[model samples]
Target chain A: MGGDFGPQVVVPAAVEAAREGIAIALVGDEAVVNAELAGCDAEGLDIRVVHASQVVEMDDKPADALRRKKDSSIQVACRLVKDGEAHGVVSAGNSGATVACGMFVLGRIKGVQRPALAGILPTEKNPVVLIDVGANVDSKPQHLFQFGLMADVFARDVLGLDKPSVGILSIGEEEGKGNAAVREAFDLLKKSQLRFIGNVEGRDIFTGEVDIVVCDGFVGNVALKLSEGLATSLGRILKDELKSSWLSKLGTLLSMRAFKRFRKVTDYAEYGGAPLLGLKDIVLVAHGKSNQLAMVNCIRMAATSVRNRAHEHLVEKLADHQGLNGKSEKSAA
Target chain B: MGGDFGPQVVVPAAVEAAREGIAIALVGDEAVVNAELAGCDAEGLDIRVVHASQVVEMDDKPADALRRKKDSSIQVACRLVKDGEAHGVVSAGNSGATVACGMFVLGRIKGVQRPALAGILPTEKNPVVLIDVGANVDSKPQHLFQFGLMADVFARDVLGLDKPSVGILSIGEEEGKGNAAVREAFDLLKKSQLRFIGNVEGRDIFTGEVDIVVCDGFVGNVALKLSEGLATSLGRILKDELKSSWLSKLGTLLSMRAFKRFRKVTDYAEYGGAPLLGLKDIVLVAHGKSNQLAMVNCIRMAATSVRNRAHEHLVEKLADHQGLNGKSEKSAA
Candidate 1:
């Protein structure tokens, strides 16, 4: 019901994941879903076609669609979770609309300030989780601190890290080196129970020095997209250089296989969807250009979250740490 | 006086630039500057040394250093500009301290709210300018607008553009799609005489769609360093993948010269220093790791800015468009 391909690519991927024993509720136009499903061999699989009358276009305003399009695919998907008919909802449509629906329909966890998107990137050492990549643009210090707390649970439970270390994304590696929000958030994290490392510079994000990097949505989104842009620009520049010379043309021909391996390490699409943390239920937002493989991977990742009870752990973590027990600042690196 | 090599590298570069017809005033400890100056044949060049009693370490706070280190090299360099003994000042020292010294020593230009750093980056098509990169972290709306105002003058003067289009850095390209500060800044830019191109996403920074990208120092710094980190990581990944196979070994060997060209397009040091804008006089802040060539390039860049009278043009533009003469929002891409 979302993304560029809409039901065309999603139907088959949902059927495939359903075949893999993950129950997938396909929410979109009933006619469109059934028509796409007819092409796939989804007989006897745990796949249900939930009729969503309206579709949220990518350009639709989030608040506008949330207020008017009650039966929109994204809204209907979230309603499935709210009504206890589904464990979670996955949408590739309007991310803003999806976030709105998740917040308005599923509601946030107790004491959670804001539900944020945890973007996962393949780094040099390990995959780093960047919280609030594009959700909740104007964040407060408390919201940023909550981003770290929620991302910590997701990283530990879903990513299988026993005790993930966290750092605030800032301009420098010093204690007092960021904007007002980051400075305040640093104070909050330093007083928490998380494995809080001191400040980390922007370059430290992909180096995987820490498992989790926390920042407001604006900076996180910029970091995510800037890294993607740089990688793309680098590839284009490398290819142009390699093709300009006859010797390099031969080099390119010989190194074709290695180029594929390089793409695997740099491509963010190789990973599944980014999880929308701080929500009562597990909702993952796949990339807008997600293909069948990506959809299947995202569905598989969501199933892992559900099986591991990541949301419950997040809720418990919130309840257990209602008040800052370790409010004494700890200077760490 | 600054950077890793300090006077050792600065002396030879200053001598070379001075020989090339740019006057150089080497400011640092008299004995250390003389010892380094003795290494180079700078007798006929217009290279003079000024004695400075103290040096500002990288770890020293900007405010503390500004208030205490009276004769620091950076302060002395800025003082030379203020006293009209030098046209411009260039330092590869602590950037925060440099900005602080530039603000207090040289004083802010008339009608300028905050002084900022304009970082130049080489994109696929042309070099792009990112303003307020780690200069002032918490920027107000009017300040972001002023950054665009000042950087527009810089792109036209130093970068040599007729009409450089400006865009506010945001999570999306639509109007009113960013955080609170960006949304307000968008409104301010739209009302100005500059060619405001609505909002630009993070990945668009390298695509060269717009000439100037304006944002606060926090997000701008993240974008700058994240791109550098990704480029470095990509190089390492490509080398590892290419060397793992004998076929790619041949490819890597043949494409060595082309790789040098790739480095030139991506290496930020090739562009030399970033200019700290909105000051009464020209002040360029070079990278801390600037070598001899980088120092010379930075000095040359400063000279270019000085010769073009970028500061005066900025002041003029600030006057001609003081009030919002064009406040009507013209929708643009």
Candidate 2:
């Protein structure tokens, strides 16, 4: 079973997805999956339960889980995609294991150097794609360029942007302002066919200045999680403030609609299921703490990706990516 | 001449700091400094103006500025410290140049591998020190370990934490979860005498779970700026919502005290200037966009560091650092 609540949360989410007319394969402990499924109204729904004997624990190492847990829920789910029984895989469980399963089991696209996780976050105007959030670390410049290429293709194909501007994340916005990898990656991106918009700082990630922000997995993951942490901490502070005074308490009720509107703009769950980019098959990683609603939204996103031929586009676009990045291809890796 | 509104901002701030009984030697172009100082109420204050011909533009490369701007204001300020004319240097100008000046002019403490910038950020409970916010990049394991060590001493001597808990920033809070350097640093930190709290994720930075979070300059800088950007963006969204309706306007007035308290907890300026640690003398780098109030606090913070003998503690503690980290020292660098 994957995620925090395993079958309990996932089953209801799958049922909801099925009701939304998306076919879902509930791959988990058969007994538990069945028990949870029995509680849902699943009449005439195209939802099937595939038994997975083992679970990938949150603390399990990706490599260890990949090697030892062949029958793990994440593995079985990925296997369904490889066998053509499923269009995509969605998991809220061990994210590292999900990524491992996606890479080792599902394999990589032909021209892909390293498959990465693209975290879609809401900005002021639109969704910004931050690639290589945590899929791989210690990335070479070539890998970062590929992450940019892959994310660019995703933004155009899935997000329906006509032309996506890409920016490599750095400490400063200047040409020679980043670490060795970023400095080199800047050159690679500058030579690429994608609408490369030089370097952007971490502050620029949430500014919606560019459609995609490319970084090595380590920094990207740190930035991603830091954003979430900051949001939570700020929310807690605001909540405490709103509750401190009787006048503010009255203000809270009157300002309820404003808060709701603010939530719609800031909620990461609103943009569900960040797809692991450059993979041969679709594998979406939901948050470890995702609820039933968030998971259902993730499943919906997975189905939408399949419908949009997101994987096929990545495969085809990477061929162009290689040719477009020919200048730095020799020096980047 | 370093940051925006150079003399205008720095002069008023220096005047304010001097009014508080802190001696300030303002290093800048003579005529401009004199003009700004003439406007300020500097009567009975310990403030002096030292003329420097050149100004280090914000976009100037650190190395370029170091080599070319020898007569720059920042350098003159650092030279003042080096000549023992001033106890410390405080600059709201070019940070990279400021770090370079701190390192080259004042020199590093014995056994210090690299000088770093330790940014002090406010959390709910206390201030957290994030080291190497933008001093250097492409950090080795030893560099990060040193950052942790330096920040630990900073927390103890300056922030008044008796035994500061230190954590290496990583994707996961496990021993072997980060990149190669972080994994190596994690082990090194574990072996040290400092209260090594194992690995901490980016989200833990604001939780006040640890007194110090150590990362490479690239990632640390990104994290620092991202926090500032997030606060601004979120504030914008909240303001837009609050102003949308009439009832929320009344609520905002009632919630004024709460918002003020929230700002107090979140203001980076409230913590004053971030010191450039590992230097022989105290050098504090304030925000480039620092207002008069912010810069005044920076000067006060610099004065406080000198009074606290922060440099003496770092030099003394690093000897213990070498011994405690004997297992990884040979391998870390």
Candidate 3:
């Protein structure tokens, strides 16, 4: 009901998670959800089925989903977290709708100005967290600073980094390398207590040297989408070239196992989903075409993020940093 | 003297170009240029050494390079084009210095708002041109429209794409998808006579469906650098995974021929250098770590661009389009 695979992938994944002693709620059309669940070993597992009357289509606008789809699975899941019935919510649905649900249903964190979406991209060294991947496109310098602060807290608390290095994504690494907004953001980040590594170019995103890369949503989204497009294009070209010749075809045959491992390492399914940070509750948005493996990992990520108390740490850290704290709810928006 | 590989890569490339009857001018410190040239089969080649007293370091600011390093290799090359001693200029030097030299030395074409650096990225399909890749950041809607105009001209004249479809790069493809600048630019592109394909997302860059993907310098630069970083990182990860086990390692050995073919197809050197479009004279900038192969391709690109008379076509087309024309030189800037 949520993803391209619908309840088929979601129910099996939920059943597996329940078997592992993780509490799970399947939020979708009850009839469809039960049909998919019937195929799984869900007997005596810690799982509950929650019904929602509407579905948010892939092409549906986020605003429309928020307004019309009040009884949508995504909204219900988010409401569950808001009501303290669930620690987190996971959706392999329309990311824009999921982001909207996170903000509109759950609301923003106490002092947060904008909730940033962190796209966790895996590198050879470690996974790099790129924040503001299209959550708030026209971001201000203060919003960028808040993004940095929240990402820093999330990196330390959820990602298990002791002291994560935050780098401002720009055209160049030089102090005055970027546009006005970036330069102003740099000045703010320099004064912050977070381990700001100064400006990092787009090339630095995959280096894995920096833990948290912060930017306005437009730039981050472009970087994320570009990586995805290129990776797919490159893989296609590599495979085409490998199969072009007899010698290469033989080599590909012998290397199938290695290729599988390489795919696993770079697969979006392995990473599961990206977390929408700066929200009051945890919300993870998986890819729309997420499979069973991806759904399972999405649940795992939600559990981990909830267990780590990322939102609480974010609140505490922001409160401790006087510059980011003490804003009234009215001023926060 | 320009790139990291310096005279070692540059001299041989120049000699090779000269061997093919492409008149080549080797610009750098005279002594170092001669020593490197001696290693080449330069017995009787159409090659001349142009001595420049200074070298623009990679970290040197563009303005500093323009004002202080007057006799630098990059400056000398652009000056050659300006003085009509050379048809075009090519340098595997600092890109900032290249763009600055192009603007200051060669000047911008009449009716052109800003000269953009078009980074030609190779894909499985036809090569796609991404314009304004760090030439002029904080660009206005007018500047972005100018980028599309210039890139469209370059694609047709140099890249040989007849009536190339130009798309404005943004976070989404919808007309109203992007930030303020992009939305404005979208309106402008639609009104213009160019083959505007509306807005394209980051994922569209590699599909090779669109000929030119235009954006402000900052966004374009991020897209370019991110692609380079991800391609390199992905290749490394794939190779590492292939060698992780003995079975896969054996496959890699068998697939060595196929791997070489794959590398060749995806090689950046094959594309040579990116042209700084909308300038009065052609100026191509190669990568900083460009080897001899890249240098050779840069020269080839420069020659092709010059032969196509891209600048003249750009000026004529821009002047014809009233939306861009009717501006004095002062107002244009």
Q: Which candidate wins on DockQ?
A: 2
| Candidate 2: regions farther than 4 A off | A323-333, B324-330
lDDT for A256 in candidate 2 is 81
- Scored by lDDT, the top model is 1
Q: How many backbone clashes does candidate 3 have?
A: 0
Estimate TM-scores for all models: 0.95, 0.96, 0.95
Give the TM-score (vs. native) of candidate 3. Answer: 0.95
Q: Candidate 1 on A1-333: residue-level lDDT in tens?
A: 889888898999899899889988999899989999999999899999999899889899999999999999889889898999999888888888888888888988878878999999988888999998999877888788889899899988888999999999999888988988789888888878899997888888888778999999989988888888878887888888888999999988888887887677677777768889988998899988888888888888888899999988988887666665233112211
The deviation in Å at residue B10 for candidate 2 is: 2.5
Model 2's CAPRI class? medium
TM-score winner among the candidates? Answer: 2
Report the error of model 3 at residue A263, Å.
Answer: 0.9
Q: Enumerate clash totals for all models, in the order shown.
A: 1, 1, 0
Shift in Å, residue A295, candidate 3: 1.3
Tens digit of lDDT per residue, candidate 2, span A14-70? 999999889889998899889888999998999898998999999898999999999
